[model samples]
Target: MPQKGSRLTPEQVGLIRAWIDQGLQWEEGATFAKAPVLNLSPRRPELPGDEGGHSVDRILASYFARYGVKTSRVGFWIDFLLDACISTRLACCRQ
Candidate 1:
């Protein structure tokens, strides 16, 4: 028993129908239950270098080592950075 005024709009119905029409391929165990918690309180960390840091890599290395993050992610991170830069360039070109 659907109510006349309380029913979904045609656009909303269409979106839902389209989603159902496509195979609902949701990732398995993709819950954000235990995502890494970052502490961004802005404090100088004890880095392995001359008193003050030189480049961002030095700072990032300390954080990565502290968090047990591996250097393998560098390739993925570089690719992601390149993709974002390309997207930004394309957007600027469109404007």
Candidate 2:
């Protein structure tokens, strides 16, 4: 589908004109499907009863531990990380 603020393609314009030429079929309750829902908030799974740590810390620790990832929290990634944090209200880089 064409994006908002974007001009309709020639094909789309033609289709609309054709529909108008056809007297515009009327169908009650005929509508496009609703857009998918978005959850802007962060979601942290409920930890086990014995787990001890903030959800953010736990998530990062688990990721690094499982994947054996290595890297200082410094460099270009940190810049992108900060931007994501700001945009997501600290959800992405909370830990």
Candidate 3:
């Protein structure tokens, strides 16, 4: 059975339905079918940078470059950490 939260294309759904209709009998040693790979690459957004650009851009670019969806608060936390580190370096340079 496909795990929850897994995305299935129409074709995949049809195949599963057909399998079930065919009695869904196990061949005794049948292995679980591998799921079709989904290309969830992030799509580029219309705008390069917006209010969520800094945070989102990094996330989408990191994992799925084709889809330009931004990351959650965790991404923002990482950004904050980086920014603080850089600022600390600059402060030390000035002293």
Number of clashing pairs per prediction, in order: 0, 0, 7
Per residue, candidate 3 scores C-alpha lDDT tens digits across 1-95 of 65888798899999999999999977786888897799999997564434554655544564554566454545667789999999999999999
Pick by TM-score: which candidate is best? 2
- Model 3 residue 54 CA deviation (Å) reads 10
In Å, residue 13's CA in model 3 sits off its true spot by 79
Error of 3 at 50 (Å): 23
Candidate 2 local Cα displacement, residue 8, angstroms: 10
TM-score of each: 0.28, 0.33, 0.26
Candidate 2: Cα lDDT at 68: 90
Task: Indicate the TM-score of model 2.
Answer: 0.33
Q: lDDT per residue, candidate 2, 6-77, as tens digits?
A: 898899999999999999886997768897799889975776435564444445665776799774442445
Candidate order by TM-score, highest to lowest?
Answer: 2, 1, 3
TM-score of 3: 0.26
Better of 1 and 2 by TM-score: 2
> Which residue pairs of candidate 1 clash?
none
Candidate 3 has its poorest 10 consecutive residues by lDDT at: 47-56
